[model samples]
Target: MKTFLEVKQLNKTFQPDKEVEVTALRNINIAVKQGDFAVLSGPSGSGKTTLLNIIGGLDEATGGEVLLSGQVLTGLSEKELSIIRRDQIGFVFQAYNLIPVLTAKENIEYVMRLQGRNQEECDTRVMEVARKLEIETLLNKLPSQLSGGQQQRVAVARAVAATPKPHSC
Candidate 1:
């Protein structure tokens, strides 16, 4: 099968000042084919989050490329990257990142709404994902009202609900 995700020569560097440069990642590479599962495991400060941020289009690498399917994500305009992120990437942040004002149901529906999906579709997807995640009972609760575990579950639900299957490569 073709590679579903590829990271080629990935490098990330941080320069806090002209006199100081910290290399976070260097010459990193990864490939995951369709239906494959992979994990990034490392101690803190080992660039795991940095790598993920680049892959998820939340950050840019100082060097290298991230490709999803066959599309190169390097050097895209911010607007283009935003569209790609919205349409393709799903992130479950370390922090739940839920909007405090929106209930769990609305958090799950937020991306679908941004994608311009109709209300019926958003409602249907929210219900479906909430049921699959066993968060149906928590739908009306705001993030502030949920426990840490519940918030994480809702975060996962939101990511799963927003991420559409990749188009044919």
Candidate 2:
């Protein structure tokens, strides 16, 4: 049973210079095996998003370790983390953050371009993911032209279009 993701003894605290410290998480431990489906559920402000952000490398954990695949991500430099995020991870935000001026196809192709993929490859991948998501016809429309659900589908297409390589934290 290979671990796909692991969080060990994790803790997160926020301290303002003139205010009391707020502890967001404490001694959290989690292990997710490859191909497993896990869900995090809690009430508002229960640190679900915080834990996700930390796991995604969008925020730093105050203490403990995060292992993705077999990589330790806790102490990596921002540049290194950026590479990891670009090559290994995909994020779909609750708010669909599409570029207003870019067409749906362009939005879906953005990350692939950032990864230096060739134009033909980018185009192919964008169409493939869009078709899979049943948004093939919407690819030429702007974000504002799409419904909320359509926009969310485009965002998901964008996240998966690059077929980012998977690696452990």
Whole-model lDDT values for every prediction: 0.91, 0.90
Candidate 1 Cα outliers beyond 4 Å, as residue runs: 165-169
Q: What is the clash tally of candidate 1?
A: 0
Candidate with maximal lDDT: 1
TM-score of each: 0.94, 0.92
Span of ten consecutive residues with least summed lDDT in model 2: 160-169
Error of 1 at 66 (Å): 0.7
lDDT of 2 by residue, 1-169 (tens): 7998999999999887748988999999999997788999999999999999999898999999999989999999999989888877778899989999999999999988999999999988887788889999999999999999999999898888865534566
lDDT of 1 by residue, 22-51 (tens): 999999999999878898999999999989
What TM-score would candidate 2 get against the native? 0.92
Candidate 2: residue 5 Cα off by (Å)? 1.1
